[model samples]
Target: MTDAQLGLLVATPIIIVFAVALRRMGAVRTTGAVVAVAASVAIAAVLFFTQ
Candidate 1:
């Protein structure tokens, strides 16, 4: 995979973890979690198409 794809793949899990942690810590609400997951999926899709 290209560097961008690789980066996105790695970052996907980190973003998920961060979102979960934020929710657990009461820093992020449900909307924030949804946004975070959506953004990560979008990024992955972009990387997939571009690669």
Candidate 2:
């Protein structure tokens, strides 16, 4: 598989895990939650596209 595909495969579950853990850790605030997820996705995007 391509790097992008691999990134998606890896990042999806990672983001999900992070979201769930962060939520449980009391980071359930709207802004913080979004920012946390967004940052992870952004990092994933960068890795996905950078190759």
Q: Evaluated with TM-score, which candidate comes out highest? A: 1
1-51 per-residue lDDT for model 2 (tens digits) = 696768686876788687778888986866777777788777777777777
lDDT per residue (tens digit) for residues 1-51 in model 1 = 788878888888898999989988999898999899888889788877888
In terms of lDDT, model 2 sits at 0.76
Worst 10 residues of 1 by lDDT: 1-10
After superposition on all C-alphas, the RMSD of every candidate to the true structure, in Å, is 1.2, 2.8
Query: Model 2: what TM-score?
Result: 0.56
TM-score to true structure, per model: 0.80, 0.56
| Candidate-wise lDDT, in order | 0.88, 0.76
